[model samples]
Target: MFTDKLREGSTGPVAKFLFIIIMVSFAIAGVGSYLTPKMDFNPVKVNGNSITNGELEQQFRLEKNKLERQLGKAFREQAKDPAFNASLRKQTLERMITDQVVSDHIFNSGVVISDDLVKNRIREMPEFQVNGKFSDAQFRKVLSLAGYPSPLVFSEALKGDISKEIYLKTAFDSGFALPDDVAVMAQILSQERTFSKIDIAIDAYKKNQTAGEDEIKAYYDSHSKDFLLPEKVKVSYIYITAGDFVNDVKYTDEDLKKFFDLHAELYTIPEKRTVSHILITGEDAEDKIAKVAEELKGGASFEDLAKKYSEDSSSKDKGGKLPAFAQGVMDSSFEKAAFALEKTGDVSEPVSTQFGWHLIRLDGIEPGHGADFNQVKDDVIEQYTKVQSRELFMDKKQIIADTSFENPDSLDAAALAANAAREEGGQVSKSVQIKTSDFIANGDEKAAFPLNQPEVQKVMFQSELRESPVNSDVVELGDNAIVVVHVEGYQEPAPKPLSEVHDQVRDAVLTAKAENASGATLKSVTDSLAKSESLEKYVKDGLIVISGPATISRIKTGDVDAQVASNVFAMPTPEPGNITYKSFAGNNGSSYVLVLSKVVDPKLGADSARDSFLNNQIYNFRYGEDNQIVINSARAESKVEYNENREYLKMQEEQNN
Candidate 1:
């Protein structure tokens, strides 16, 4: 079990801030710095083999950018907070590290995915198919569109992904068990005991305790390091969106026609036909359907009769009208009959189907036609113009980045270069402060200040403020544009003084002291319960004893806390006087103490369902345990190095004073 331990009450606002700072600092450092002098940008160095930094960064950025785009401006803005970004980076790095570890282990274990398997998997992919069969053209087109150099490389990457998935599955497969084992386990798990439990309420203990100012101050002085705040910055930024470009571009008739001529397939409409049906439901309804078919053949009104009896609510109200449908949209028998009709207003005989009987009418037909240039002109012009504008933006941004780097002193020179790249008659927007911080923080979302986006954020954070005044590399923003960001400002985090948060420190100390006292009280109660043996005696003596054995699984049971359940399962089997302890934080400055009775293991041959249940249980346990072993081994083998810069730590110490 990957149990997440809750932080103790010693955590204060200042301590939390420091934690965030350290996490963020580490995250930034992970991406920006190498783990060891001998190691390059690789996240993992396994027995001299490395997973390069470039590969990890590329994958991370691609995934990050894809998410930013999908979430749009609102969600991107929410994700843009420095603290959020820092957390995201940490999560990403941790995942990368974990993946690298797993990958290294897999390789060392000699697990391999064959080329034949890769090919078979690719064939199974729906995207590489047309008409339910794999198409080489489609496969190549998709691979090209995705920027994969070749099918072999793409297949190899997929193989690696598949191998990792298989590895994990093999590791975690233990959690499931056979039905027989489950039945036996359930019986043992559900077996009721008459014993009662005396919970030493932490809240009661806390209410009895009182802390003086001197005691609180003394606690604070001893644990002052827990009260120091980390450095933080407040920033304001603005961002210009790519969608804004849609409003500025104009579509001319000639441009539209040209676009349509170049991409005619996009505007072609597929053949479609309107259909209607009347269903008769029951056993042997086919005989009744044939009689209706005969009546239709005799020219009985299809619409009037359908209205009186049609079971399909969608078409019944609209005179049995169904909107135009193409192949595969309707049932096979219905579709075959509907499409076989030679002309509009054709009616089919009552047909036998899973729905019983169907009297289908073909109301209208729309023949497939290649759209005329004039008909699709506007759409073509919009698409082509946007594509052109995007290219133009990239070209202009590149010139600005290059020229600015070459001539570090003149902002005018960069602007002129940018303006020069634009087409004649095209108006240029005001010069925006393009900084890497803006792109990093805002992603694709509009920023409060233009320079705070990720593209800008990267440059601002990476470039030396004094030495590298301008960044020359073109920062690509999706497939739309590439923009260069210039560093405008720099701010370093500073620690806050102890006097600023003395009261907060005092409160934290009090809470910690209370928790300690409560823990001690809980231990005493549990010890007493063990000595007494009968929980009924404790209840009679005034303590409340809550009695009931709970049914639970590894997958959380809603009634009990997950941590509590985990701890309970870890205890030894029931024997009189045996006691186990578990604690959890509670609401309103309170805590919970759980006194556990020994678990009763099920008899192996107790149930007829034991075999199946045991199988599943064995599988689940083996998988979970093996996975943990793999993870632990990987962690132990990998190396992690933190930055030596103690400026933040020093500030924290000063603040504590």
Candidate 2:
């Protein structure tokens, strides 16, 4: 706690921001005033300040966007929870309320936010920075998206946020954790749970209890919809894919020969040449060339002359070297001159191309060889497949669709006519679940087309069930695969009969009774243990007793069940000399009775290993609670009142709906 960076007399803006963050566990920014104008039709009021409905909705939407970004695709699942959505709305509204509360406190407390500070804060914001400087364009673009139409309008909100930060900074800076309180908290946080647990597994009672026929019937009568299936279909589909006929459509030697004859260019490997170059072309090119030729005739080495006088940036070092090249990679004149050389060590006179003059040398030559049928059999087969498939895919696809739509019956006839059809059957529910396989071939999840795609589920579940399963129009999985679904069987949602769901009902009845029995058993055991102070008898009676991990000082115990840990902490600390005991329900369909025989305070050195007293954890926690008290005081002093306009209630109702 004493080693925290946010200490007294720190003047850095960054440090100041951290202090405020620690204040209320909230990032409150800006100070002084509300941004929108007060009006008679205001929907919400905080600290006597009226906030317009439009402003509330705008803030709500901004918060909603942030939540969606955090949630990603999971937001779709969360949206289904009314409680979560309600909490989301409540938190957003509460944020607006908190803003007003904090703003009032800031103004009364004499906290100030200046234009320069606001501008500096904006410029430092990563969203508005381009190439490490504040970009006006980026700032405006962000504002436009955020529904802040003008820089002026956004400045007000920014100013308000800064004011709140200042108010919190003052409050947090004044907070102090007393030495005695720190000792007690540290001891509690570092205490370990040295106790053993007795688990009452639900399975143990299964043999002793059974849901009789009448009980099963009675349970089913009351909870019929529990067994009612969402909507299911038995589908028989014929999948037509390139994979289906890749092996069947074989390429023979004769076929390969014909294919080779048509696309023979692709098989021909062009001749390659190994070459090197040097160039001398500047102001005195003609004069320099004659001197170079004279020096070459006088036995001056070509490499030496090139190194001393060549102007070419490339190949100037390492005595001029170039990679071997094919004909088309170089300029025509250069290619011709280089290829014209009969042997290695041949040199050509300086020749000009687009990149200035060049002194060409032929280091080596490699003759080109055209691949025969035996050398490229795989290529021939692949080319043949691609060519054939391209020419035939459209026709095959259309014919499959036409036949299935026209007949609405046999997939057998369609299979005879297209790429090839393979029969597949499965049950589908309301969504994309198709009983799938882990097996994959060539990186493809080998689900026959219909069940693999969710789009088909949307179609099939919406379509009326047929008595005699028949094919529907083709549903294309992708460009390469297509299939037609036959609704062979279906079961509509209904109250399931006791005979049909007898086993399920029996299990449910048993589980429910087991849970109740476990709860009752737990109460009885805990009562007996507290009175008798002995767990040995219960431990002997098939209650699997195991010692739990050291957890009091532990902040993160991922291996332990969260519910069990929470219940354990919620257990009262043992009376001065006596141990404490409690009962908790386990998520594994079991009951647990935990005994806390001791509170093991952590052993520490001057340079502590434990974190309870480090990082200002206790001080920060107390500050947040104290900061809330200050905010409440400010809000209560304001004498706030709500207009409760009809339109405001209607707006909220519509939003909830």
Candidate 3:
């Protein structure tokens, strides 16, 4: 659902990385070398395959551009925040890893997704619909508009998603509960009650005394387990990207002319028209269009006619000033009629289309023109170079992969093969146990040892890594570099020293002690109020009684606190001077004392308020509990490995701070 609005090329790190690797491989084998590593191009290795920095940078730019459009003025400001950028990087990496995991699962399970299913899913999407039905033209047009490279690629993506959904459904089906259980929960939760209540303030105890040093230290000693620190990593990185070279590039006048001559079609502007309309509805729409056209022919006001008859609220009020558009941008019939008008102030006779009929007027026209050679030369050159770079990078990466796989033992052999295959100025570098974030920041990681990305953590901690001479998987870091890491060393997490968390332990102990002291006093005060018949007596004893015996149901009380409300609703009617009830403070530190005054049983009621309360309680309890149960069950069944690089998480936190 979140990916719905995104264009095909606008992907998170992992998808981009995968795409780049595949494309680069294809390009390398097909075309000669033009890619240069010095030109802000880097590669992340996964298993034996490489995802180029160039590809990732391109995808990142596309995504960034999309975000900029959405964010408008704040784009530059938001982009400058290091923490925000890090978060975006993390999110991209996580998505990529999750996708890889899902894809792996799909392959392992042998879940088949047919081409028809992908087609059906695409057809069902509203973007591909015309007149509430699937249209091939609309499908192709929408895909093109969404930047989908090809129908085959889009279909494959859909199939992957469908396969994942199917896998989830299969895995989770047994977790769903029966209707009877849900209904019984609904009935039980519907029961209501009338009650009296009072508040037991924790601030009442502030006057007691300040805690002593000895007490604080003792508390700290007892709560050291709660203060244990998570493992952390310190990382340094350098980033290389295509945009870095954009300003450095220059195109001479001669180069521009040559480029323009070679790619003249790219600069040729299509004929464009500005059209306005007075649309009318009803079965007699054509007759209305004809009448309006006749009236306009006789010098009747277009503005008045549009305001009177046009159903298009957006343009009709403005005398039908439609936005300027090029040919192939509008409905076929409408486009044809609008473009046919050669002169300004020309009006067509009635034109019929799907939405009804329109009396069209061509307000202006822009005759097509070829772009000046100097004006677009730089852009043309950039495009040509990018294409060349893509081909070169792909071929070089594949050679590395092939050589690495064939050798199957030495990274030196692989590196040698990569170097041999690379074009002029292209080079390969390696780092082990390095974080993906670091790789993204710095184009090379040779100075570092042991790549420590979250994706690598899985392999690093795996038992297989100990037995095998080499282990590798493609890791998609943020900005589209697919890294294939070879696990060199494995480190398991161990408990941190007590000295490392002395201050943290002290703070935890102090908070716990404060809560216990305040909570005990609050509980005593509430217990006294619940047991006493005279709420005024409790008020006299330094507690506040909130009087007005309102009929608050368990549902309303449940919203306050489910655990506390449960205890309150279970209480017997209060007796004079008797006190023994549980009390606790809410999240906002507001303590409540509930005294049972009356109980109402289930019955057929015309009372909408009562019915509504019951319905809410039933839905909340059953649905909430059932959803939790399903989630727990799914989590239990799945083999999830956290393997989070705490060092990376720490680095992110440090940057944020």
Report clashes for each candidate as comma-separated counts: 53, 10, 22
Ranked by lDDT, the better of candidates 2 and 3 is 2
Clashing pairs in 2: 29-161, 29-162, 30-159, 30-160, 30-161, 30-162, 30-163, 30-164, 31-160, 31-163
Predicted model with the maximum TM-score: 1
Give per-model TM-scores: 0.51, 0.44, 0.42
Q: How far is candidate 1 from the true structure (C-alpha RMSD, Å)?
A: 16.5
lDDT (10s digit) by residue, model 1, range 269-346: 756788777777665567766776777788887786677677778777676788897654677667767776766677
Between candidates 1 and 2, name the one with more favorable lDDT: 2
| lDDT of model 1 at position 49 | 55
Candidate 3 regions exceeding 4 Å error are 1-225, 229-271, 278-299, 307-318, 326-360, 364-374, 391-474, 482-503, 517-657
- For model 3 the TM-score comes to 0.42
TM-score result, candidate 2: 0.44
The 10-residue segment of model 2 with minimum total lDDT is 426-435
Model 1 / residue 301 / CA error / Å: 27
Q: Encode model 3's per-residue lDDT on 201-255: one tens digit a residue.
A: 4444443435566765676566545544433222222222223233333456666
Candidate 3 lDDT score at position 52? 42
